[model samples]
Target: MQGDVFQADEHGPAEQPGERLLLDLDGFEGPLDVLLALAREQKVDLAKLSILKLADQYLEFVARVRQHHLDLAAEYLVMAAWLAYLKSRLLLPEPEPEPGEQPTAAEMAEILAFRLRRLEAMQSAGTALMVRPQLGRHFFARGEPEGIVVVTRSLYDVQLFDLLKAYADHVVRTSVRTLHIEAPDLYSVEDALRRLERMLGRMPDWSVLSSYLPAILGDPLKMKSAIASTFIAALELAKQGRVQLRQDGGPYSPIYIKAGGVAA
Candidate 1:
């Protein structure tokens, strides 16, 4: 029913054997499609199709195509080779397994059947989806104007710069002065030494160095000058035995200048 009678092989007709009728397959997508068509015509289940017979049919079909000198796709030839390999592997005797070991699961017929079943499942799914309702086909969406919210402005409203200037004025008025205002740097080391001597002469003999520093150094600038001058004066006084400077803690600790034999 599928193809005209050309010749007969050992099997009565192309449809009688494990193979299918010799139909023109130039329009078929691939070998699988041809196989599926044959299975459908013969009312055979793809999962239960005979692997050896199927391979034989495919090779026979290829030979017929070659005989007719029809232009063949490389994929068809490749499928022919694969079927030949499957036929050989299926016909071969199973190898004996070692003791306590199972045989390999790489059987050719099982793999081909599994793949064919999967293809059939996919084809059925595609057919079902083709009849289902799709978007932009069965129904159309309503169209409406996109609404945009806009705000109205008044002529009396203040601008961005006005708000910024108000904030700046508030900051300047409420800010506390952290800067230390000090006297000029007119006094030299000698001037500082003289000022320290006057303060020391009036204080006790063992007065703390830090106690007299505040009185001798009037401001931050004077304090800077007095520190350098006082260090030199203390060194000189200690060298001359007029005063002794001793620390209360470790390095960089508080120092106390005590009067020695000398008066001031």
Candidate 2:
């Protein structure tokens, strides 16, 4: 059933797009919700609307809902009772006031009107937000870059930690035990190079660099001389196409020396 007061103007032949023949109270959240909707539709100021006759309209709407056997909530009934009380209070004449006494009827009406205004404002904001374009709905984020593939390290790459560990091991292995003698002994890179050549002749085709630097495990002076000679010898061999040096896996991996042509 339709409400008489809630019905749109029918004086004009054509009705507006949002104009409805009946008030759909079911669309509202509560009694205040219905009042807010009605006030917004009519563009009525909440504070001024209390002075005008709106209590009867509100009560009639609630009564109609109850008459239709529609399940009305307790809030709706409570609001109806409050509206009846407000109406009665408005009708009665004002009593003689004591000093600084409360203005019950006007204050009550103002408070109710203020609350209704706030509710109406929030409803308007919510409705506006519902219509706005959202992040995922209106526009989507761009997919991550698929073209570029980053490689952190390549095969046989020597990381810093591995290099440091290998150096530390080399230091420990090259440390010499002290031996006292009357005469001081001297070592040379040439002596180390000749020794390395003889060792390589007896060794396999491909051997680790340590195999040619056995002096590192003995005297510290010999170890330094052998290291210098080994570097020069390797360079000379590579130039003459006599030896090839390689390091496989990480930095901790042995430096393998192979006969480029034939070992010197």
Best by the lDDT measure: 2
Q: Which tens-of-lDDT digit does each residue in 1-264 have in candidate 2?
A: 332323222232323245334443556666788777666655666767753366777887777666643445566678889888888888997787789987688778888788888997887899999999888999877787568788797577789999999999999888866887775354565766676567655657678876776544657776776676776777666677767777777977877787656543
With a 3 Å backbone cut-off (N, CA, C), the pairs that clash in candidate 1 are none
TM-score, candidate number 2 = 0.43
Query: Which one wins on TM-score?
Result: 2
- Tell me the whole-model lDDT of each prediction, alpha carbons only: 0.67, 0.68
Residue 39: error of model 1 in Å? 2.9
The 10-residue segment of model 1 with minimum total lDDT is 1-10
Cα distance off (Å), candidate 1, residue 240: 44
Candidate 2: regions farther than 4 A off: 1-25, 99-103, 145-264
Q: What does candidate 2 score in Cα RMSD to the true structure? A: 22.3
Sliding window of 10 residues with minimal summed lDDT for model 2? 3-12
User: How well is each residue in 1-264 modelled by candidate 1, as lDDT tens digits?
Assistant: 243323333333333343433443555656787666555655677766776777777888888776644435556778899888777766776677678764333465677677778888998999999989877999766688678899898786799999999999999988967888876664465765665667655656576666654454347767776676777777676778767787767997777787666533
